[model samples]
Target: MEQAAKELFETVEEYFQTREFKQFFHFVDAAIYLAQQIADVAKEIHLLLNKAVAYYQLGDSEVAVKTIRKLQPFERHMTASQRIRYLNTVAAIYHTLDDTAHYYEYLMQAYALATDMNEEIALLFLEGNLGHYYYEMKEYAKSFMHMERCLMYCERLNFEAHEPYIIGRVQYINTSLELGKMAIAEAQFERLEQFPHILTNHHYVLAKGHYYCICGDKQRAYELLAQVIRHDGQHETILSTLYERFLHVAEEVETLEQYVETLETYYHYLGRLKEAQAKKQIDQMKIYLNTELLEEMLWHDPLTKVKNRRYLDEKMPIWLDEQHSFVGLLLFDADHFKQINDCFGHRVGDEVICLMAERARQFFSSESAVVIRYGGDEFVVFYSVKQLEGIEVMLAQFHAHMQQCAFTVKGEVHHVSISIGATVVRANVPIEVLLEEADRALYQSKQQGRNRYTQFQQHA
Candidate 1:
């Protein structure tokens, strides 16, 4: 199954080369199906990521983001390269969404991770992505710097055959043109022509058209650009450039009808572009609402209204992988909860659980920690903190609050107390190890008499 997916991905790459996005999307779907049938998470991540890329390339930014979000739950299964690609793709999608902050944030994350891993191939592509980002931002100097680095990596890695290398060279020429380095642009364009595939690539043709327009060769520019407009008219970006180019070349044309036809086509594409933009906004809003609804239904505890154990399981791997400076894990439960249920009836026991959950939520808040119902009568708090003293103080305040709170059962005043076991550590460790540490401390709390907090101490 994995082999079948791999073969389909290779075909998908060919479809991409031919600019047959619909065919590319179909092959990606086939690969995803194969990956799913085998429960191959790594392959599935790779294929789904490509699917998102196809969506983005086809100008469906909202669906691209929706597809990418579906992979978050499986992120822990991603390989290092896959993770970098995920971040890069996410950054690109955010760029299309006009979210400049997240665009830079995730791009830098991909760069940082690739650098840390010494993944030269990922770095090469990331350099090109950064270059392209700066180019779009009209920061030509910065774009040139990254593009230079990207080309250097391309040479060093012998990656000249790949799309990144080709695109990087194209962007290099575009940046040079923007910076008024006409000589550099000419030299790079000459080098770009050596790639036989560039002859058929609309991007290269568009660049050449722009070059000819700048050089005052209106006839040559019109011919090359006309080809691009004919082949790639569906894309807003391509049409946007063609609109301006055709306007510039309109005066040199033999007949006004030629320019008018191009104008009509551009207006048609603009209308479609606007319609797509509006639909994208609506789709994005729907995705946001559905995401919120899904999380509330899937992650929240029904009775207590806090997060549930499933939520903890989903989040634990992500938190652990982050390798925070200080992590504080706290496990607590209502003392003699079974006895309260047995003696006071399940109804009163239910009230006690609800009251404890309410206090936990109040004390912790969303800012301080993630409070979860690990099981019946058992609650857990995961905290990222600078100091253990802060946790101790919070626990003290939480216990004090519990003491002051009382409820009436059968017209009798009754107080519920909780025993807590906590461990604060500074290293990356498995969740089970942390749980075991907290459990040992909890055992001590129970042994020393309930209604107290115990901190685990690691002996030297």
Candidate 2:
């Protein structure tokens, strides 16, 4: 019966993973029915929660809210993780309903729970949502603060191209532009350009168009905005803003024909925007659902869930091919990791390794830095910096973070450290030679004393 339950749960998980929302709803229904038959309170709650989330995602907010409210009696029975999920789902429902006060209330509750549970991913999602909320409220400074926090988590989790990070980056840029922070917006634009997928994304294109509009490039802005209208005409809020911008630009057109054409396009977008708003009101009564899943194998490390070695191998060549110079590489290994495994068992050792990876992630939480779990207890970080001083500061942070990490085994606390080697790579240098230099420096650090970093000195 346990095996059957396990298989059933796996099937449900696969349905969710594959983004088969309808199938996921059906599976959850079946699971709930079976769980009720077996009188398994925990399993029943779990399935019901899944059902509520699925309903929420399907645009059945009323049903979802009602379903979740039924779980109030069982709230005390939920695990910490399950409770966090429940709170987050409630926050999402409020957000959908445009109930800003309730959204913030539930989100903050979820944030506190996530922090207490050390659930990094959940905290990141909450931060991103908060950022979006503040951005929409026209509180630029507050939005930037939350978006920056989201960006840090995105970097730490190696989720550079993920939806949350992408959205956060766009929001950050938009707010910066609104605040007349042209330099900051330009810098963010460069980073946004690094992801080719952004060019095709409706929100990204709209943000880029706004940036151009702010920078006094009316023609370019109009072209980009047109692309956005073409692709995302159904997005009422975005189209409403785009329509206003179009009208503003149309008034500034030099030629009569240009003015007339722009005005016609503006009217078209306005019509679409109104139609979309009406459809949205109708959708509130009907069900809407779709799913888009990311392929995790390309970038993720299976064990530590950081960027894998393959991500490093694939990404580095692109930079090298582009002749990106002054790139810094840091290769590090856990100090006395084998000794820990021998003394504390492999389970504890694995935990220590994961801890080290997490520390590396925190240390390298910058857009330019790419942290990879090279293999086993060793990790590699590649970062782009014009000056060696920047690399030194990062290395210092890495050392400090390592010193601060604490691991507990059977009520006994243990400290772990890493030995790191660093080297700066030039465009002309072979990738192998760059890696070897970093590896040599790492060996020197270990030989001198672990928990320190050594820089590879280039021979003239």
Candidate 3:
């Protein structure tokens, strides 16, 4: 199945290179089928990413974003290359929607990751995108720097004849023109034109138009720029800038009738751009809300509304690595929880569990701690000693609070007590070791009394 998946992935890449999105999706489906058969989560995520990019290339930005969101849950499972691809694909989708905030967010994320990996090809995509981003942001100097870096990577990787290199050249030329470096821009433009089939590139045409517009060849600039607008006007950023450039030239050097015609076309594209922007705003809002809700659902326990074991499993390593002070791990278990369920039924037992969770949350609310529902009738409180002064006093206060908390069922009052085992360490340690020590302490608490707290102690 792995070999079959690999072949399917290679075929998908071929289709992607050819821009045959339909065929690309077919291979992706086959790869996903094989991935499911083998429970290959990484391959599945990679295939889904390919699907998202294919949809994006087909101009379905909404579907592309949705597709990427579906992979959020398994993002941690992605290998380094898969993660870079995911980031670049997300940036591309956001770029298509003119979502500057999200576009730059993902673009910079990919750039940082690529820089760390020292992956030249990955940097090729990221640098070109950053060049485009700064270009649209009107940071001409920064845009020029990124485009130059992109071309440098292209030359180093022997990708000078590739689309990314071509686009980088075009953007570099346009950015040069923006910075008033007409001589350099003209020189780069002539050099870029030497490449076979470069004359038909939309971006090349746009750059040429900018050149002519700058040289005061108004008629030539109007013709080339207008051609780009007609062909590539669906790209809002490009269309907006091209229209503005074309209008300046038209108003200056064209006849009154020609200028009026240009104004009418410009207004049409302007209206479309506004409508597109409104739609993008709506889509972005929905994506943001949905992503937030999904993250909450993934991380929180539905019953107790605290972090769940999944959250601990995923976030503990990251938190531990970032911890700079002593750490405390406390494990709590409801005493006689099973007996309560057996006597009063599961419903009342559930209510008792909720009551216990609420008390714990309130007691720890003042401390820098995260309460986690580790398993049935078991909770874990992870805290930092730096933020929490006097941990023993806080634990005593919590015990008092739990003692005072009572639950009533069918006019019968019931008191709930909990046993806690805690361990604190001043040095970095494995979570498994902490858990084992805490569990031993918990056993001590259960031996001494069911309704007490025990701290782990090392005997010499």
Question: Which ten-residue region of model 3 has the weakest summed lDDT?
Answer: 284-293
Candidate 3 yields a Cα-based lDDT of 0.79
- Candidate 3 Cα RMSD after full superposition onto the native fold (Å): 18.4
List TM-scores for all candidates, in order.
Answer: 0.49, 0.55, 0.53
* 74-170: candidate 1 lDDT, tens digit per residue: 7888899999999999999999889999999999999999999999988998899899889988999999999999999999999888778888899
Q: Which one is best on TM-score?
A: 2
lDDT of candidate 3 at residue 340, scale 0 to 100: 90
Counting clashing residue pairs in each candidate, in order, gives: 0, 0, 0
Q: Write the residue-wise lDDT of candidate 2 on 306-412 in tens digits.
A: 78878778777776666565777889888988999999887567677777777778876557777888888998887776775576787787787778766776678
Model 3 stretches with alpha carbons more than 4 Å out: 1-10, 223-247, 260-460
Model 1 worst lDDT run, 10 consecutive residues: 284-293
Q: If ranked by lDDT, best first, what sequence of candidates would result?
A: 1, 3, 2
Q: lDDT of all the models against the reference?
A: 0.79, 0.77, 0.79
Question: Candidate 3: deviation at residue 182, Å?
Answer: 2.3
